[model samples]
Target: MVPRRILLETGLECFRESLNDLHAPATCATHLIGCVTTIFNFPPSTPRSNAEMDVMVKAVEKHYEFLNLAVSFVAVPRTSRQLLKLTTDLAKCDCPMSHPGSTQLHDLGQHWVNDMACKDVTTLLYFLLFVPSAILKGVNKTRVAKGSNKHWPRSISDIVPFGFDALVEALSQWTVVLANPIPLLFLGDALHVCGRPLFTAVTTSPTFMDRLISLLRITCANMRRPQKSEQLPVSYFYIIAVFLFHVMAQRTSQNSIMIWVRGRELELYPILSEAVTITKDPKLWPRTVQRDATGIAMIVNIFHAFAFHFSKDVPRPPGLHPELAPARESPEIEPVIRLYDLLSTRRDECYAPGCMRSLQEVGHAFQKCGACRKVTYCSKACQGADWKNTEYPHKLICRQLQSFIAASGSATGHPKDNFFEDFDQAEAEAVTAPLLAWVKARDAQKELQDLEKSMRGLAKTEKDEGAVEMIPDLRSNS
Candidate 1:
């Protein structure tokens, strides 16, 4: 076998040759200068340093090669757009499945995409931002129909699908590298690209939604703290949590619509509650900050998308009997409309008037009753008295309330391991009667509210409007 020293010298020579061939002379020289500086700056050699020195030397050699490679690629002269495409190809080529040895190559692709997206955005910003007066001159002006609006730069409807593809691919790779959140940043850019003006097609696009939700679910389930009690990286927690919150709120809404139609209230209630919880969390900023914001905006976007689609796209449940169709003609459909309206409105905003303060502070009220966990307040003091006073009346209608929200998603079909399914399992295994009671009570309260609304409307037409209308009269008339 060759002596170890010979092996070391050969390895160093290979590194040097790679630099010579792949890099420009000036670029190569610059790296060599850095390497030389590092070498001389290496402290005086001692007797204790032979093995360590060899390892250190190899590390320095690798750095030299990396610097050389970077310089070489820079000197190769490619437009930002060409470089962007090249980097995308490189990323795909270096995907962990295809080129495991160059897995780090993935990072290079990420960096390139980031640079190009940012640079392109910066160029556009410069034109539109500083020189809004010249916007007409910069563009070849033309009128476009709503259906053909994808061509506009401001709308970015054209780039949305490409952005979706990029996000899906990046997130797919992210399952393998949770600690490096660089890919999520790319997902964010894609999100922004799809979100501007009216790229509703991108979010609603069936092709992209599946992959997006799949990535989100896996990312959330994989989050774990590292061993040795070290603080897990911030990116790990942030990316997973944000993704989970979004998936629970947005994707599930779309998926749950079919469930809602199926009339699976037992399975659907918890999911709707969870969705509300995610949206209600004040710690979550609805707005994205440039640094930690990319994947998050998708949450807000998808929520609105799901709501819009639910309003315009969802068909009335066919299961409703012929007799109920007449009820649809009544103005009392207002409460039912309001309930559907709640699905489309931001939960915080929808629930705001019901409570005196925002849900985060002193939460709307009734948050204190053991039955009121479904209710929330900004603080404990608000919860305390509110619970005692409302508990008895609220208890009567809690189950109906939960059932209505649950119906929002569970009406379609019962999905295994899904939110609806998990809720059923939770109900069966529930160890605490109080917890179950609270769930039941919340649903009941919602039913009472709907009944009250229906009765109140009927009362106006019949007897004393001053007296509360009878539930029996409204039910019999229906």
Candidate 2:
């Protein structure tokens, strides 16, 4: 019965020597894996709180001699599935290679790093970069020699033992296993990344976005409970809302969200209310501190009804829903840049309503909106229709986009990340009108639920309701 502190100190000493000296990388990796497996793996049976458990687990990772210098044990054995989790904590950090003249790291005669001064996640990435490709090749070799003619399963995610940490890493390893020849990562911006046929196959699949939404619903459900039994940390949910806004938050999902959202507003409202409600709970998240998760749960979930996009589209309409846009004194926003200034921005389709023509079909000729200059039109007619059309008219939002452009100029304009970094009162008030509406709807819902519970004469609390097994599935359903 050795003290845990002694084990910790001894392990740290061993880990320091192993990493700094580059002395037997495999042995060190295996040792740390065992340490992490025994000391860090959280079972429901564990006595400690999740916060204390998290602190202990994070203790294994330490800063080395240099400031940004850190390392991770990346020699993953196929059998040890729990150690593969690199979400929540690692996703926020980016890995960049160090300078030219530092001690080069060599593993099996191959240089893994030129210098030691790199972030912990970077070290993980460096080692993991090759391991996945190798594992993939070895798997193929086994299949080939065995004369197995079975094609890769479409439900590859269901069969995979580990949930991949990075989406790129997943694509790299799983795509090879799934036998996709093209690499989608190297393709440039969001437009290019979303456009690839192989990428589209996964994104455009009927079940893809449905699965994503279900998982989000499941997490939100878990958070509503009193206990700390979460499938994922808050950060992952924040990232999902920000990155997948087109699918998750947007109203127009007809052409492509790329798959599921499909403008089903009823299916969206319940989750949004739950997400906002949970983040407001002091028992769940601290009231004094502001979390990006709370901000995200607010910003993205604020009325799915396009409140943020109203500046002034047309003359007074009788029965339009009220929005949180600025007061309507401003004139028509003149376009900022000329035809040469459009910058292509990798857009393939026109921004105007009812314009189905692609860049390819339209001979790559498109004109920029004069006011905001952010939107492009395939022709003058479609642009005109989008501006004045009563239903979801683009005319209302043009000046708002123009204002964003004005605020977000390059070296010439204010920084894009300024007000958004903190997600303060100013930002909250900007969307305050619709957010208030959402709060009212949620209150109404709570009253109805309470009434129903009273009629039933009994109801289990949320804790009891969420006590069922709800392990999160972050794995891509390829």
- Lowest lDDT sum, 10 consecutive residues, model 1, at 125-134
lDDT (0 to 1) per candidate: 0.32, 0.35
Model 2, C-alpha of 101: deviation from truth (Å): 13
Model 2 poorest ten-residue lDDT run: 332-341
Local accuracy of candidate 1 as per-residue lDDT tens digits, 189-298: 33322221212333444443444444444333332222212122223335433333322232223444333223333222233223323433444322221332333333
List per-candidate RMSD values in Å.
Answer: 20.4, 22.0
Give the lDDT of residue 185 in candidate 2: 17
Clash number for candidate 2: 7
Model 2 residue 347 CA deviation in Å: 6.5
lDDT of 2 by residue, 1-478 (tens): 3355554444444434445532123223223322232233223232236355445334322222211112122222222133333322332422121312111111211221212222333333323222222122113222322334143211222112232223333333322221221122111112121222223444545544454456557656555556533222343345344334322222223334323344443454455545555554556663333566546544444332212222123232233222222223321110111111122222344666666444534544467777755577788898998887654456655654445434433222335434222223334333333333333443444465456555444334433676444323222321
**TM per candidate:** 0.26, 0.36
